[model samples]
Target: MFTGIIEATGVLKELTLKGGDLALRVQSHNLDMSDVQLGDSIATNGVCLTVVAKHSDGFSADVSNETLGLTRFSQYQKGQKVNLEKALQATSRLGGHLVSGHVDGIAEIVSSNSNGRATEYWLQAPENLMKYIPYKGSVAIDGISLTVNAVEKNRFKLTIVPHTAQETTIADFKVGTKVNLEVDQISRYLERLIQGQSSAASESTLTTGLLAKAGFIK
Candidate 1:
């Protein structure tokens, strides 16, 4: 599991897609590699990938075919910047909400506004995600946890402060760019609650009508 918090940024070195498996190599100077071993899971742009190899300047992970089909990581090109986060440790703080480090789907950046200190990423999600995004809801974009600053039709905006931009690659957002999106987990819980309430209401109404016909109640 991850907290959707980005720790650093890296430049893509290789996206080797062969035999239906993807091997990504990226250069991150901030990641302390001295302790990282092979087979460790790292969150790359919100996708939890296992480390296949490690080097002084970078590491590589095998991306499953399913992950490639579902996320924008497959669209990454050489030298592109990407968000990076290490897997959550037992001792790490749970700053953000529970995140599986799984990319549900890709969302498109509709617009952007940049100031020197901050940049805003406006994105349009698919129809399936429209009901999940709400005002002040938590969202993970390319693995960075952010709040919904504003929402439009199938669209939402996130304001990236300078600190967040520096830690991740969100400062480079541009129109038409694709990003991995994960909605708040609480939204699913809410849906379940609504379904349960509807079921209870239907049963109550049926019982009431039966009782009235039998003269047990008016």
Candidate 2:
């Protein structure tokens, strides 16, 4: 798991293609790697990648085809900047929301505008994923945890402070830029619980009418 708090920004140093996978090497830019080790998980642009090799200034990880298909990794190029966050430790403070580092879908920046010291960005999420994004709720965009300022049909707005813009890759975002998105994990679990209960109820004699008769509903 990750806290979605970007520790630093890294550059994609190289991308090597193997059979059906990709080997990624990223150069750390001020990110502390003294505690990192081989086999440790790192959240690169919101996608959890296991470190296969470690160097003085960077690390290498292998990206499978399945992860590539679900994320914007295919669109990345050498020298591109990406948000970087180390996996959360039990003793670490919960500065940001809980992030699985699992990209649910890709979202595109629809618009951007300066909002005084902050920048308001509107992003269009996938139709199916929009249900998970709610106003005032949390969403991780390219590994940076942000609150949804507003929500439209299939889009949501986020206000990025100057500190966030400088700390992460959000400063480099532009219209049409694709970003990896991870919705709130709690919402997903709640949906599954509700759905499972509904399914079980459908098979039994419990119905809305019965509940109303029992004064459970008005």
Give candidates' CA RMSD values in order: 7.5, 4.5
Write down the lDDT of every candidate, Cα atoms only.
0.80, 0.90
How do the residues 106-204 of candidate 2 rate in per-residue lDDT, one tens digit apiece?
999999999899999999998888878888999999999999999999999999999999989998899989899999998776555554665754533
> Please, what are the lDDT tens digits per residue for candidate 1 over residues 1-218?
88888777888888887787778798899877777889987888888888889989879888888888898866778898877788888999999777778787789998888767778878999977767788888988888888898998889988889888767777677899888998887665545554466575452233345546656568
On lDDT, the leading prediction is 2
Clashes of each: 0, 0
Worst 10 residues of 1 by lDDT: 200-209
- Best-performing candidate as measured by TM-score: 2
Off by over 4 Å in 1: 114-117, 189-218
